[model samples]
Target: MHKLTEIIKYSYNLNLLYVEDNDEVRNSTMIILREFFKNITVAENGQEGYERFTEQKFDLIMTDINMPKLGGLEMISKIRETDNEVLILVLSAYNEPNYFMESIKLGVEGYLLKPINMEQFLVVLNKVIQKVQLKEKSRTYMSLLGQYQEVTDNSLIVSKTDPTGKITYVNDEFCKISEFSKEELIGSNHNIIRDPENPKEFYEEMWESLKGKKQIWKGTIRNKSKSGKSYYVQATIKAILDADGNIVEYIALRSDITDIMNQQKQLEDLIDFSIKPILALIEIVDYNNLSKFYGHKEISHIETVFANTLLQSVPNKKLFDTVYTLSHGRFAFAKDANNQDIDEIIDNVKKALHNVNSSSFEIDGKVFDISIRVSLSYGDDILENCTYGLQKIKKGHSDFFIANGLAQIEKKQAQSNLNTLEMVHTAIKDSKIISYFQPIVDNKTKEIVKYESLVRLITPTNKILTPYFFLDVAKKGRFYSQITQIVFNNSFDALSKTTKDISINLSALDIEKENVSNMIFDLLEKHKKDASRIVFELLEDENVKDMNVVKNFISRAKKYGVRIAIDDFGVGYSNFVRLLDYQPDILKIDASLIKDILTNDYSLSIVKTIITFAKSQNIEVVGEFVENEEIYLLLKELGVDYSQGYFFGKPEPL
Candidate 1:
C-alpha cells in the first residue's frame, strides 16, 4: 500500500505522539506515524508521555492501555482534564470491551485496533476533529461561564427595589451577599434586611431619592442576613424613569464594605487614641549583600527597644500592637500615624540606635562595631492607597528606603475576634481540636472500607473550636508540623486501638520536609500493624519539587504496604487536572464539588468524569462532604468508588 505520508501532507500538517511499552510496537508505530506525519513524538511509557503533554500541547495523543511506567488510560484521562479538545485515540492491541467503554466515558474521540492503521487512522482523525472542535467550543463556554460568575458575584449586593420600598429583583450574587434567596426576597420589602443599626432616616432619604427620580443616592446601611450575620452595605441607588417622566423602578448597586468599615474604624482609632508611636519597616541594606551586614544587632535590639524608647520618650505607647519580622531580615511596625514627623523622628532614633551599635564594650579585649539600618513608617498601608500616589517622604532614606512591601495577611483586629481565635487556639493546644472518622465504604460491596481521620477542636471550657479557628494561623507558622504530628499520632493511636484501616492527612509541609513521614514510618515499624493499615490522603496542592517530596513519601509509604490518595482535589490552590496526572491509588473529590452535587449538574458531571477517569487508571475514587442521602445516591450512581458524609455517619471518635 502507498505510504499515508502523501495523504496526511495533502490534508493537514500535525505532530503525532505514539506511546507504548513494547519496543517492537513502539518502533513500528513511530515509522508509521513518520510516514504520514513529519513530526512524530514517541515515548516508551504513558508516564513520560504525560510529562511531555505538560511541557507541550500535542494535536493528537495515541497510546496503548497497557504500558510499563504508567498506563495509557491514565495519560488519556489526565489529557482529557485540561485539553479536552485534543484528539485522544487509544490503540490498544487487546479489544477489551471494558477498556473501550471506559475510553468512551472519558470523551476519547476514537479508538483504533493494533497492527497499525494508515487508512483507518485517517478516518479516525476526521471523526476526532469533529469531537475536538465541539469540545473546544464547550470549553470556551465553560470559561465564559466562570468569568460571568465572577462578575455577577462581586462582593457587593446589587438589588432593585420599587418606589414603594418593596424588593423586586436581586442577582444571585446579591442573594449570596444577603444570605437570602431570590425566592425569599422577590416580594419582600427591603425592610426585611434593615438592621436596627440603620436609623429610620436612612429609609426616609432612600424613598425621597426614589420618589424624586434622583440620579444617585449613596449611603451605608446595616443589613441582616438569614443567618443573622450583620453586614454593612455601601450602596448607590439610581432612578429608572419611564418616558412619562415617572420613576417606574430603581437600580441599586451595593458593596459589602464590612471589612472596609472595620479597617476604616481601626485607622480612625489609630489617629485618635494614639498610643504606640511606630509604624515602619526596618531592613538591613548593603544593597548586594545582606548576610551579616551592618545593623544586625541594632535590628535585633530594635525589636525589644523600639517600644521602650517610644514609650519612654512618649510613654503613652500601647503594648498590644504587634510587630512582624518578614522574610529576608525585614522588620516592620504598624500603628497610629497621627502626631509624629516619622522621618525626623526615625532619623533621630536611628542616630541614637547607631550610637548603640557603634560603641561595643571590651569583648575578649577586642572591640567590634555593630552596623545596622533602621527604616520606619507610620503604617504598613495597602498597596492601592500608599503606592498609587507619588510621595517622596514615604520612600524616605537614600541607601535604605522604607521597604514598603505590601502584605496579604489580614492583620489581627486590635480588639474583637482576637481572643476568639486565641482561646480556640489555646484550647486546641491543650488536647482539644476534636477529631473524628467517617468510614470510607466500598462502592461494589457497600461495606465499611476504611476510616479517614478528621479533626475538630473541642475547647476545655465546653466549647467546640472548629478548624477555621486555628488552621489559617497554623498554616502561617511552624505550627503546621506539630499540628500534623498531632493528627498523625492520634490517628495512628486510634487505628491501633480499633480493628480498621485508617487514612490520615499529611500536611504538604510534612511530606516536603519528610520529618513527619520519617517519624511516622519509625513509629509504624515499631507498631507492626500501623504501616499496613495506613492511607495518606494528600492534598492535590502538596508541593512537589525536584525530589517530588509527596510522591517520594507515597512511594516510601507504599513500600510498607500503605496506600496513597489525593484529597480535596480541585478546591483551593490545587489544579486537580494535574492531580489526575499523578494517578494516585485513590482520588477524593473535594467537598465543594459535592456540596451542591444534587442540584448542580456541573458538579455532578465533574464527579462522574473524575470517577470515569479514575477507574480507567485503575484508581479508586471517593466523594467527600455528602451531607444527605440525595448527595450520597447521586455520587453512588455516578460510580464514585466511595462516599463519606453526614448522610451515612458524621465523623465520630473511636
Candidate 2:
C-alpha cells in the first residue's frame, strides 16, 4: 500500500488527458483517475480530446477506442503525426484481435480490457511514469549542457581531444584565434600549434598531470598560428573521467593574453636599453585644449608635423640616445650624462623648439600657430622630474626650464607623500579615520537642518589632519576606498544617534569603483528607514568619465529616498547640462566664490547666476564658507536655501 501511495504521489505532478464518450463510464473512472493524477482533463469525445491536446501539453493520454466524431484510434494516429513521444493507453470494451492490432500500430503503451482492473491499471501506469521521469531528466541535462557550451564558446577558446591527444572538436573562437578552419583542425594532433620555444619538459609535465594523475593543469603557453605568428594564451586543461575513474578525454579552455604578454615584453625591453639618467621632454602648450577644438585626427596630423620639424631642427641626432614618444603631445629625448654637457644639449633643444614654433602649420587650408615648452632634468627619476617642471612652466611665462631646482622640491614632496601614506596606513590600522559633522542651516529660520560629514585623519599624536594632507597620497596607495568606507560607516553611526539629516561626500572616483558602489547600495538596503535622511554630496574636483554610471547610481539612490547634492557647484567644469543629468536636490556654492562675494562683483555675479539657475530648476542652494553675519545675510537676501560655514559651527564630532 505504501509503495502504491509513493507511485501515486509521483504521478500527482503529471498532467493527463482522458477521453470517453459515455458519461457514466467517465464519472466512474474519474474517482480512480483523481487519486493517481491531481491534474486530469476529461474530454467527452475524440475531437474534444484532440482539441485539448492542441491547447496544452499533456504527459499522458488515455482514450476509449469507440467514440462519435473521430474515433480514439484516428485521434491517436493524428497525434502521433505531430508528437511520437506522448504516452498513450487504450481502455476499450472491444476484445477483437483487430482492435489490439490497431492499438499496437497506433503506438499505445497498454490496452486494458472492458472494465478496467485496478491492479492491471497501476502496473501499466507505473511504466509510463518511469518513461516520463527519464525524459524530463534528459531534457534538463541537455538544457544545462547547451547553456554551458554557449557561455564557453562565446567567451573562451575551447577545444576537446581524445585520450590519445588527437583533436576531435574545436569551438569557433579557437579556430578564429588560430586562423584555422574546423576542417583543418579536427583530427589533428594537439602539438600542431605548439611553439618549439616551449621546452619538451613543459609538455611532459602537462601530459603527466592529465593522463597519469588525471588532474587539471593550468599555465601560460605560447602557440604559433597558421600564419606563423606567435600568440599567448592562459590555458586550463583537465581530463574527463569515466565512472571507473579512467581518463576518457581532455578538454582545454584558454583566454587570449597576447596583448598583456606583449606589453610586459615591451616594458622589459624599455627598461633594458631605452632609459637614460638625463632626459629632456618637449611638450606642445595647451595640447588638451587643442585636441578638444580640433578633434583627434587633426591633432594627430599636427603632432606628426611637429615631431618631423623637431627632428629636422636637431642637427646632431647622436646628442640624444633615443627619442621616445610619451603621451599627451610630449616626446622625451634621453641620454646618459656621464660626459655629456647637459646645458649645451638643453640650449640646442631650445633652439630647435624655437624654430618649430616660428613655423606655421596648415591643416585643411587653416593655419595654426604653435608653441612648445621644454624641461631638462638629470636624475634616476628623470621622466617624473621633467614632468613636474613642465607643470610648473604651464603656470608661469617660461618657455624653457631646467628641472634641477624643481627636482629638489620634488624630492621633498615625494618624501612628504611617503610620510603621509604611512600616516594613512597607521590611522586606518588604529581606527583613527573618522568623520566630523558641520551643520548646514536653513537661511530663513536660521535653524539647523542637516550636517555634512567631513573625513579627518588623526595622527598618533592626536593631531587632526584634513584631506589636503593625505587624500591624494592615499589614492595612489589604493587606500581611498578603505578611507571612504570608514567615513561612510562613521557617518551612518552618527545618523543613528541624531534626527538631523546627514550628507556624505563621494567623488567620481568613488562612484567608478564597483566595490565602493556595492557597499553603498548594500548599506542603503540594510538601513531602509534611515535612507530618506541620507544625502550624497558629489565632489566635482575630478571629471566623471561615464555619466551613465552616476545617473544609474542616483536613480537607485532616489528609489530609497536619498537626496543628491552637487558639491562645489561654481567650480571645476560644473555646467548646466550636468545639472539636468544629475537633477540634484541641492547645489553648494564653492567656498572660493562665496568667500569674496561681498567685495568682489565678479564673484557676486557668478553666485547670483548660479542661484538663479538653481531657483529655475527648483533646486536648493547652500552658500559655503559663510564666515560672518554680512555674508550670511547677503545670501539669505538672495534667497539661498541653506548656509554652512564656521559661522554656523566648525566641523566637529557629534
lDDT of 2 by residue, 1-654 (tens): 227987898898999999999998889889888988999999999999999999999999999989999899999999999999999989998755567657766777777765777756776787788779889989987876766566566767899999888999998889988999999999999888989899999999888878875779998999999999999887989999775467888999886767546544543355346434566788888786665454333555676666666677775766754455544677666656566776677777888778877787766688878788888777555566688999899899998888866776878988988888889999999999989999999998999999999999999999999988889789887588799899888888787889999999888667866689999988888888899999999876436767778889899999999999999887632233466577889899999989999998757866875776677667889999999999999999999999999999999998
Reference-based TM-score of each model:
0.42, 0.49
What value does the lDDT take at residue 217 in candidate 1? 86
Say which candidate scores most in TM-score.
2
After superposing candidate 1, which stretches have Cα over 4 Å from the reference?
A: 1-425, 443-447, 570-583
Model 1 whole-model lDDT (C-alpha atoms)? 0.64
lDDT of 1 by residue, 270-321 (tens): 5356553354444434422422222323333443343333333322334224
Per-residue error (Å), model 2, residue 34: 94
Off by over 4 Å in 2: 1-412, 539-542, 545-548, 570-577, 601-619
* True lDDT of residue 389, candidate 2: 91
